[model samples]
Target chain A: MASDDTPAIRLAGLRKRYGTGDAAVDALKGVDMTVHAGEVVGLIGPSGSGKTTLLKCLGAVIEPTGGRMELAGEAIYDAERGGWQVGDLRALRRDRIGFVFQAPYLIPFLDVTDNVALLPMLAGVANGAARKRALALLTALDVAHRAGAQVSQLSGGEQQRVAIARALANRAPVILADEPTAPLDSERALTVVRILNEMAVQYRTAIIVVTHDEKIIPTFRRIYHIRDGVTHEEAGEGRPV
Target chain B: MAGVYRGMVDDGQVLIDNSGADLWVVQQGTLGPYAEPSSIRDDVWRGIAGIHGVAETGNAAYLTMQIKQGGHEARVMVVGIEVDRPGRPGAPPYLTFGRPILQGHYEAIADEKTGLKLGERVRIRRHEYVVVGLTRRMVSSSGDPMIFVPLKDAQEIQFLKDNDALINERARTAANPAFNRPGVPGLLEAAQASATQARNVNAVLVRLAPDVDPDTVAGEIRRWKRLTAYTRAQMEDILVAKLIATSAKQIGMFLVILSVVTAAIVAFIIYTMTLAKVREIAVLKLIGAKNRTIAAMILQQALGLGLIGFLVGRVAAGLWGPAFPKYVLLVPGDALRGFAIVMAICALASLVAIRAALRIDPAEAIGG
Candidate 1:
């Protein structure tokens, strides 16, 4: 642990199942981990290895079978209350969480600025204010020059970065990246990892990158590996490369 | 209702009298009363002209019933007007063929609907009259042909009798003989009076000056009680609302039902479309987008589809309006109202799809 302060995320006994009886399939089995703020961690697993299930539970995208998960010193999952939030979980995610995916699924109709601004606007921020915030983030992310461009016009890397800017638009304290560099070249993949690391340190964000990308695995000092619904923790070579 | 009667109006441009005045002064509650057997006294125009502001008046007769003209028999509204003074109000706004009844004696004008060619001779009630001119689209309110005839001849045709019936009536009077005075020439007076009165007609037609208030004189005519009169505006209202009110109501009900049906169709379509994109919607849901945002996007798209359909329908209806039989009156206001209703229906219809979209679980995108 880097500091005595509470970690940005704490998880214990996380489990997931699709159905009951003989057809049941357990995806996550009692996983436990802790990641402090300003750290970029990797979740590596093979196909069908519960990596996606864990990410979903972390993002509030799905309910866990049984778990105690906390975010930013707040209890998020209690199997007793059913891992679902009592009210609008969507609002919780929009204000406090961010997500990055394998492909950049930007809204084709809106420009890059608007794509980033859309979340804040949905959260009651005025259009102008939201755009200003989005512009600042895009400038920080190096995609500000292409603010006016439509999503279709951006190159793959630019799109990926724009999507990253969109993810950080609300300045969420946590980000969950799933195979974000899968479609990029080797250089682009490392560039994306470097950008994720810089963003985590700059924003004091806790980022969880789920990947099968072996090239970037050694870059994370802390890595969690899971196989057949069970996870094991390991420390990687503590080097930026 | 007028859509059903569009055939006749499409074919006519003829107005019986171009210089006719403002008021039609029909029977108080009638307009082209073409579906019923109705008539007023021939001399009704004399009193109407005597009214203040009534610039000129003339006798006009209208009979709407089954009439045999040429070799064909169909329901026609026969309007008899004098060649001078005021033109008949029921004359159509357009003329596609020959001129209106601007000719002198023995002239007749027929709607293209009646299939009467120019200069054709037709016999009505045994009175031979020449169709000197052809006219287009002179339709009665009930969607029937309006045949313009010379006033005197129309009166005579309407009044003309069979010789045997007239002779029989004469025989009955002669046989009645109260005094049986030989020098009295028994049947002569009764027969002559009956013959003379038979040619006298049903009602008068009056046209007032443009600036005159027709309602005032119309009120005066109503006071006479024996005669009834209607102004031009009143006549159009009566024709549209009163005369065709029942059919209009029927069509209105159909339109309402069609709108509801269309709304249901739209809702189902939007729902189906949303369901097809369930995974996509789930992804959007998981990404922290609010339900209202997703709902609005679907609603806007549904409205866009409605707007497109309406434009296509309006254009289709307009292009096909002319080829219909009878009269199809596609009023501008009706189209505007239709557009408004379409929009409302689209909005209401989108609600179903929105609800379905909102219900999608965000976890579906993850799918354990």
Candidate 2:
């Protein structure tokens, strides 16, 4: 288990460039950031400010042109981990990281319970056991009554919560939420932020919430605003609505 | 035994049939639906009853003709049976709707495939017979409706012509220079009338005793050398394997084409549906859903769609098959085989969509 003092994610001197020569365009110049356990941090940046690019690198979705990435005290990508000899990068992504998108992209055919249970089931857990864990999480989130309901039947906020439950289903140490509150009202956005904080504290998980929403901006005590692929850290307002 | 029996009867040694069995004795060289055509004494059942185990027998008839319906003329075989008398071998095994002919002159029984309603009338060989009864799955060698009529009526249709043609024929014969000279023109008409009445039958039906072996009786009939006989089992085999064999193959070919078309349609539908969810799939990948899991989901959906489609197609085939002029027999075993085939096609169809989804990059979801 990763403790609160241990950093769940670390990026050092990260750089990413698309194409080469005349068509070359650098997406990430150099990024340095550390998100420790039990901390829900905001990533605030303008559109195309390399916020997505940096997030991709930090999430290990895209390989960096140059840098080191460490998650949960293990160095996943470095000067040495980068050689062309590795057999699989997909397996690495599946086992280590979790993601929550801007929209609650629940599978429509599945019910609310199975939508959250799907991640654990994908990890080879038995269906009954995965569903059991899903129900437990749903109960904790106070949405257990809707477990049998189809995902299409759930409201937007409820659907986002189900998506969040899905992100945490595998019990990964790090969660990257991409504009998770983008479609919500101010109260719902703050509710999601508060939920993320409680989940991080309870699960000892590190969370990075990438957003441009101002309503929940002050809820995060720590913030990383990126520009031109460079990130600068600042203490958030820490104000309660 | 039929030849020997016939010999004894010709020699005035025995009475009608004392043997009891259910059988179809056809023409020499013509097995049931085969090459030869057989004619028997119309009242042979009376003799057949005197044998050993005949409960009862009836004259069942079959011949090919062209029927005009819905403005399209199609060549079809007309199977005539006596439905007025129940418990006869020639009667339909079951009735679907309406009453049996039961001694009605113009009433007839028609298979559902002939597009005849229970109360409809059909013109067979210039005689309008009312369809008072209906049967199911009763077809001839060439997939035609077996129309059950009274033995007398079927005989009329088989041999008798219209009043004008009969009169013309009698006049032509009466005008024959060798027979008439000049004294009697209508005199020959009376003689031709008697000749027309002697039209007997094309086959003999033998119903055997329950315990008696039909194989032995068939062998006996063949020994008579002047006739042919078909046991029940042999008749069914001839009907399904030889008579309808080519037709079965034709429908089988249609089945193959339909299977392929179904597979292609399912693949296209599933592939298109999957493409619509590319972003969701990529996000799923980035969020750590396994490739196999996603593949299984797509596969299951394809299979589910095929299952529903198969149900609809089968029900549609059944509901509308009777409207066709030719017989369309949808057997239960055929339905089961079709279901298995549909599932296999569905499984194969999903592979294309699965491969497409597997190739989606998780990075795409993150960057966009």
Candidate 3:
């Protein structure tokens, strides 16, 4: 029995080192952060900082050398074990975590509906149920009209919306977005930010957006500035959508 | 029916010659003139006729010779048939033009493949004969053309020696004390005379009555005559299984090499297609697609390519098989077996692509 106030995602002293000995590079010395449910935080940094590394650690794409990570009140990694606690990391990523890349990266052979439905399918949901869930997400993201179209047939903004729909399909507890709006114009970028904020609150999902784009920087209510493989939290303007 | 022989009996109605003949006597396991010649005396036919279940019999001689025509020599199998009787066992089944040989000597009927026109002179041994008829597909088992000649003429041409060789042989015999003794002067002459005469034929072809059993007759011939006799089935086995065994082995080796080349080509093509989609594969892995799913996709694509190739190959073979010089037997069983083999090869070929795809790291999808 966990309390209602438990954070959606929490990291305490997350460390990742690339190699050993004097030639080794420490990508993330120790990253500590927390985001509650229904919160959207911005992870901003310079080029050589550990923004990408921290996002990868949270997304479970790469293993952190030493860390304690918690998702929805469960400890997924502990520094004492030196690895993830889950038996199958891939299943954890499929069922609990969502990712949005700089590029849409939708599978070219599938239509928009299939692209969004794939996440639920991978988690062993039936085909009809998965497609229904995908359709509901597309409706929420305002891309339902293009659900039957091929990924190549969609415009840039439409592709981004579809990608967002995919990220929200499985109702994951957390979403790690790596520069999701970098390729869009200023107006389109703000629209994407507003959509992300709405979806976060609507689904009660905690999202961390890693970006260097100046257009949507002020949209975040809380911002973590990482430099020299470390993070410092600061409050944003908290502008209204 | 195209290569098999059918000849007219005394009634002038054509029937398969093997069906008309109850038993055939030849050297054991020899079916064509390409092998060493075997002969039995003409008197043996008399012994064969007296056997039970034996009805009527004819004598035939086989010899492969080089026939000179238009200043070019061609190898042909000369068959000696009885010119004294019409519809003899050794006669050509049918003729397309001209007439059968009416004279006992100095006349011949040739297969169309011999390229002999009517009234053209062909020299065999020390004699010349005019071609009187042309037959189609009257070839020996090994596809050599057949030339029909009178029995006595064929025996002489096959056995007679040249004048110089004969003289030398006689002098050599005379110098040997065992054969040239003055006490047995007539003995040497008797031997010389016997050597000049042709008293033997290669085999006796026997024809039975309508109600007779050929297997029983063949058994009696072998028992009483003390010679090898063959029923049609036995002869077919000897010709197809024993005589052509080496040729079958050669064809089997060719098929093995072709299968290996097909496997290699399929592996290369599948590997190239898999390489083209490496980025997509990494993304799929990052998105939690299992390794088996990716492998199955590649395997199915490879099998599809093989199916397309097999269909095209089968159609091409069907269209061009008749144009080849030798017979090309393409049966449905062979095609089905070939399809199975192609599918198995394609499945095995996709393994290389699968191994490469499984090694892709999912983290590569994220930069750095």
Per TM-score, the best of the predicted structures is: 2
Off by over 4 Å in 3: A1-6, A35-48, A80-82, A102-118, A131-169, A178-223, A234-241, B1-23, B28-50, B55-227, B232-236
Q: Model 2 compared with the native: what TM-score?
A: 0.77
Tens digit of lDDT per residue, candidate 1, span A1-241? Answer: 2254788888888899989999999999899988888899999988899998998889887789898888877778888776654466887788888888787777766899998998788778899999999999899889899999999899999999988888888888889898998899988888899989889989989999999887888889899998988888899875674
In candidate 3, position A236 carries an lDDT of 90
Instruction: Sort by DockQ, best first.
Output: 2, 1, 3
Q: List the residue pairs that clash in candidate 3.
A: none
- DockQ of all candidate complexes: 0.40, 0.48, 0.40
Retained native contacts per candidate, as fractions? 0.62, 0.57, 0.40
Candidate 3 per-residue lDDT, tens place, A165-223, comes to 88887889898888989999988889889999999999999999999988888889899
Error of 3 at B4 (Å): 20
Instruction: Give residue A17's error in model 1 in angstroms.
Output: 5.9
TM-score of each: 0.71, 0.77, 0.71
